[model samples]
Target: MSTSAGAYTYSMASNYNRVPKSKVVGISGSEVIELVKRRLLKTQLVKMFRLLQSLFQ
Candidate 1:
């Protein structure tokens, strides 16, 4: 007898041919918006710093 239930599982060959779904975690609209904001801010800051360095040189 098996020690655990549903221990013996078959591969995809046993089932019908179909595309499987992808699962993603830890993502939301608010999180996406926050990431975009951070990237934009960083780009602006880098450009400003480069301009200052060039002027001083």
Candidate 2:
């Protein structure tokens, strides 16, 4: 029984390994683009804030 259970788990793991990384992570191109855009906007905002602080000082 233990051996059969172990074999079943091993088969499942092998199947998972065969799956695509993007599908497993569930992130599509659109989601990735949005994430990148958000990151860029955050960095731009931070830079602008820093510039304003430097000007004020």
Candidate 3:
């Protein structure tokens, strides 16, 4: 009879969340689209606020 710790070696790549390197770099189509959506929405909102400020100024 033998009992020992069922140890497993730590690994990163093996369990990586796999957003491919290109996706992480925002090079792929979906990532590019998401990036554009994020930036455009932010800039649009900023511009709208600036316009509103000018209108009230």
Candidate 4:
């Protein structure tokens, strides 16, 4: 877990001011078998806005 955390910064850093995105992956002794991906900021913002609009309707 520590190694994964350390690698996240380097592996995930894009441009400054950009929202960082990553997936929590599951590995089994050098083999990856599971991954949980995340939506980007734009997608998240859009979803939130849509939900807010629906609530007001």
Top model number, lDDT: 4
lDDT at residue 57 of model 1 (Cα atoms): 100
Per residue, candidate 2 scores C-alpha lDDT tens digits across 1-57 of 112223234334322233211212125765633221112345556877999999999
List clash counts for every candidate, in order. 0, 0, 0, 0
Tens digit per residue, CA lDDT, model 1, 14-37: 213332222222358656222211
For residue 56, give model 4's deviation from the true position in Å. 2.1
Across 1-57, the per-residue lDDT of candidate 3 in tens digits comes to 112112232112121442211211135755534321212345556877999999999
Each prediction's RMSD over C-alphas, in Å, is 19.4, 16.8, 17.8, 6.6
1-57: candidate 4 lDDT, tens digit per residue: 323355565466553455545556667898986465644778767877999999999
Over 4 Å off, model 2:
1-39
Regions of model 1 farther than 4 Å from truth: 1-39
Local lDDT at 21 for model 3? 18
